[model samples]
Target: MTINDIKNLLNATVVSGHQLLDTEVHNACGSDMMSDVLAFVKDQSVLLTGLVNSQVVRTAEMMDMVCIIFVRGKEPSEEIINLAADRGIVLMKTSLRMFPACGILYQAGLRG
Candidate 1:
């Protein structure tokens, strides 16, 4: 699914990268641990996470993740958003928690 599809599926609001809504996403990785993400994620374009920090953006950068979906209604700090914006990474937030958010995307055909 494309990022737009995920947005619609999750009822997410874009925090950044509005111009990148059309970007396609083949897979996603959901985690609160950056170490796990770095250790296991492969070719995943989207990250569904609750950890809101500069390191989240940094981790996405390292993993080449195109977007981050903040679950559980969590919001990324201004610094985090600005960091993602600088890297051309998309950031979004959803009211759904991690598991259900991942499920919604998976049900919509995104895999990892």
Candidate 2:
């Protein structure tokens, strides 16, 4: 699904890279641990996490992820947003917790 679709699905607020909402994402990885994200994730385009830090953006960049969704209403700082914007990665946040957010996307056909 498109990033726009995921946003709608999760009722997320776009924090950065709004212009790239049309970007398509085939799979998703949900975790707050950047180490697990780096070690276990593969071929995933979207990341759902509660961790609000620049390292999250860096992990997404290294994993070639196109989008990061901050779950549980966590918000990234302006610096983190700027970093993601610079890297051309979409950033969004939702009030939903990680499990429900991941479930919604998975039920909508986005795989892990």
Candidate 3:
């Protein structure tokens, strides 16, 4: 699936990287713990997280995720947004909770 489809599925608001909305995403993992995310690095995928820190972007970069969906309406700081922007990772915010966000994406065909 593409970032655009994910946005529609989750009713997410793109916080950055609008130009990357069409990027392809094949897998997804949801976690708020950066260490746990680091433990499970695979191919290009999407990350669903409620963490609102720059470390989330850093971890996503290390894991090579194409996009990050911040659930629970959590917003990252300016530094975090800049970090994600520099890494070319699309960042979005959603009102849905973490479990529901992950479920919606998985149900829409994003998996790991």
31: Cα error in model 3, Å: 0.3
For model 2, residues 58-100, the per-residue Cα lDDT tens digits are: 9999999999999999989999999999999999999999999
Better candidate number, 1 or 3, judged by lDDT? 1
Candidate 2 overall Cα lDDT vs. reference?
Answer: 0.96
Residue 77 shift from truth in candidate 3, angstroms: 1.2
Put down candidate 3 lDDT per residue, 1-112, tens digits, no spaces: 8999999999999999999999888999888898988886677489898989888998888888889999999988899889989999999999999998888888888887
Best by lDDT: 2
What is candidate 1's lDDT per residue for 1-112, written digit by digit as tens?
7899999999999999999999988999999999999999898989999999999999999999999999999989899989999999999999999989998888889998
Tell me how candidate 1 scores on lDDT: 0.94
lDDT, ranked from best to worst:
2, 1, 3
* Candidate 3 worst ten-residue window by lDDT: 36-45
Q: How many angstroms is residue 104 displaced in model 2 relative to the true structure, after the best TM-score fit?
A: 0.4
lDDT of candidates 1 onward, in order? 0.94, 0.96, 0.89
Prediction-by-prediction clash tally: 0, 0, 0
